[model samples]
Target: MSDSQHHNEEEQAKIRTSRALAALTIAANAQISVEDACASVVDESGDEGLDAIGITLARGEIYVVQAKASSGSPSPTEVLKFNQGIRYLLDWDWDSLGGKTQKRRGEIEAASEDDVKVIAIFSHFGAQKTDEAATKLSDKLLSEVNSSGNILDFQYQGLRENHDNRNIASGLGLPDYDLVFERWITMNDYRSEIMGVVTGDQLARMVDSFNERLFDKNIRAVLKATDTNKILDATLERSPQDFWYYNNGITIVSNSISCARTSPRTADETFKLQGLSVVNGAQTCGALGRALRENAPLEDVRVTVRVMSKEGHSEDFTKKVTRYTNTQNQVTNREFVSLDPYQQELSESLLSEQIQYSFRTGQTLDYDEHAFAFDLEEATRALACLTGVDNATRAKREIGRMWSDITANPYRELFPRNLHPATMYNAVQFRRVFDERYMASSRWMDTRSGGIIKNSTYMACALFMQKARNEKLDFSDIDLDVESWVSSKGADIYGLAAIVVELHENENPGGFPMSFFKNRQKIEEFARKVRTRFQETGS
Candidate 1:
């Protein structure tokens, strides 16, 4: 072959590799394999304008991908091409399509009529333009499809700098395990499902073994260390038998499920599950894990399990089951937390001081009570700061993860049983005060300059608590004179905010302001500065 032909082939190979790598990154998110994706050389050869088009064998969902390796920003034409390809799939114009796409036409056509999830992927090596003309076209396509009563997500993987395809399946999947699902009762009313009980011991062991992956199919991420999760732990510890009746059991969606032959009536059914996901009861699962960590007794604990066998064919059906089971009259974690006596006690304590603490999800504060009303999250914020700089950083990071460990290190440190409600009230009032005075005084907080100072609020509250401790403030006494405390600590707060903001903006900080807040060393350094300032000013 001529040198020109050889060079042309090499260039073509580069383009193919680049596009395939980009496509695979997005395909990975759909749990689609590289073998499953369009890694073929002539992916863009089709007049259909898509680089890749195929359905996931596991989910029966379509993936229409458009990829390009660019030195600069990806052109608007790429999005238009992607749009053309999606429209082709919608219409199934087989006669004009390429050989590879045509081969998959039967699968595409089968899924076209159904309300399937079409992951419209646009993978590129160039920088993304969220509001560019191309982006507008992409958004238009997604909006058009989503509005048409289908779940269409445009997965954009803009691989600007890195070209590494090695991390494609870095997150492969949850393990397939065989668990004994107790006394399975086949549900005749619902198609392809079985109801059974899962012991807390077995569930806890699964959580310990699998961790977060066990809840991968769940609509919600593993909500660890929430009040609801803590409540579950408490239930298991207190009355494990009552848990089955009190708790709404978990729902599972399995890739494949096969029961052992002829188990006796009382015998636990041994089901071999190839792949599975807990579609509901993420809180229960997470709490079970926490319970195991705390060594909470799970002796008599049993949770009901309803498994919807996906079997690949029923992917659409399983999707609907995951949706309705999770959304239909769902008892929110907030509701479960509200049942905890600590919440009611805290509510009553705060109410006595003319502050309404809304703990439940649907519970609303009166318009008149807006000044004094705060929700569970707000209280967490205040308590987080009051716990001092270390726990404050954890709260800044993820307070939800800290709030549930009431029996242990983090939250137990904050809300010790003997810890006065007065202390909590004071901290909350101080939070409101700081928020009202220094934090919300200006409109520029959304700006770059203000964003720096905006992140200093938590630190400010923490510094105030530290000062209160140094001064030996009355914790047991319910003092309604929050304004007095605020008046005393106002200077310290302003000083801390100014100092922290200056340190962040002027000094070469590690990361973003929010990230800097989450950093322990950074938080400690800033706290030290604030403490030094407090000493100098003699507050």
Candidate 2:
């Protein structure tokens, strides 16, 4: 060994150290571990393949982030690689057959079923252009999640010029993360829509029940915008036997808008006409008092004085006066709380002017869609009359939730056995489908129907489908492998089942000889037994 040679080797080592340091610096800046970031690799062997590195642990259903590192910018490409590696690590089953890979996290090897999850952390990997690979992996994920007809979603910041991955996910019916976020916003909107239909305790109980039923289920059950309208509607309709799973962990009810309004009026008031001031007489010279145009009918008009007579007392007054009435008096008949000649006439003129404008526009009630929107409108009007909190968004949301719950979620836990098994299944399916769809779809309010209801539209659609399937009952040419045909045919099956059950129930409501919906007790027992059976079967 020559000294010169030793110096050359030292120089090479310094370069390697600098490159590694740069990688770490980049990862930190990107807010990802070096393991999550990927440095391009020139070769599979030696340090050329080195990039980021980290370790991870699985917890229940979500992946627990642990020691991880990224080696470059957190670009979309980097995200793809990181996610791919994570998926690979999660799916790996070491005990199955092949020898364990070097990246295997030892702790997971002995974990039981409950402890396992499709989650992982990474330490190191390199960027490799594999559009084909990315496409295949994303497709598989979408298929797996959507096959069961569950809502799927994803979220990311901003927009992209080209997002093949997102497009593919959408085409396969998997919602991007953004969809979930949007649904959450929509859920808030829906809460506002239904908060006016029920009482406070009832709403609270509904939420409590929903949360309780979902507590034992996975977090996946907590999708946004759950259509509590069905349950709420059922309650409102006075159908007592249709409440579904009680403990879903989410808020079940909200305060009604009407319940939240504040009334603050002592009684009716009257105002006598007051002489008009001539402060701006020059401005109105041409039309001192030309025939006044009457817009609104003289009714329930209010007048108020802000100033005080050396004392702090409000000078507000009301009047009921007619406009352009042709009568024997040749004078307009008016009623007022008090006639302080100075205040009464002026107030009446002003009131008349405002009413004229109101009448021209034909201003009336603003229509809403809830079954009981009138009640809320009445409340709003009453509250407005009192004068305090005028517009209450929270109150409305609370009220809407309450009303929706009462209308939906029937309490028929023990459906009579006279109802056929298929009918029972359809009912169960409707509840499930309604819940799932309601959770996913935007709130559909029908003011004409009453007030703002939740997605009873979905249930209505379900019913329609149920009927359609029964009518178009033909599955002789079905081929399960052909995706399009399979889906098309499945719709028919689901619909037919619903209709049959409905007909059976209608035909024999008085203790029909059916196994599933025979009577309250039998149906209840069957539900318990069936649920237990499903659990045993690992469904």
Which candidate tops lDDT?
A: 1
Per-model TM-score, in order, reads: 0.50, 0.18
Candidate 1 lDDT, 1-539, residue by residue in tens: 12224457778676656566545654465444344444432264554566766453223256666666664555677677767766555545465567767776665655543324677766666665543787788777766544424456676666632344346345446557676866777755223577888788888887666543456444542353344565676788888789999888888887877755654244476776667777888878866766787688886888988877775465486667767776766553435456557778888877877878887887887759544777877777888888888877777765655655445667667767776777777778777877776675334333443555666677777887777777777645675576677776656666656666666654432223444555677678767876786677666
The worst-scoring run of ten residues by lDDT in candidate 2 lies at 174-183
- Residue 98 Cα positional deviation in candidate 2, in Å, after optimal superposition: 11
Model 2: lDDT to the true structure: 0.25
Residue 112, model 1: lDDT of 45
TM-score of 2: 0.18
For residues 1-539, could you state the per-residue lDDT of candidate 2 as single tens digits? Answer: 12224447776554454334333332332222233322311111121112322211111222322111233223445345544443333333222212223333343332311212233222222243324544454445444433322212222211131123234222321111100010111223221321111122322222222211211112222121122322332332342222222211122111111111143112221111121111111111111111011121211111111110111222221010011111113111011112224223422332332311011112343234211111222222222211111111211222223222211211111112132322222332333343344333222312211111121222233333334344453222222122332244443433333333343334322111111131233333333443344334332
Best by TM-score: 1
Estimate every model's Cα lDDT from 0 to 1.
Answer: 0.64, 0.25
Candidate 2, 149: how far from true, in Å? 16
Native-to-model Cα distance after best TM-score fit, residue 301 in candidate 2, in Å: 57
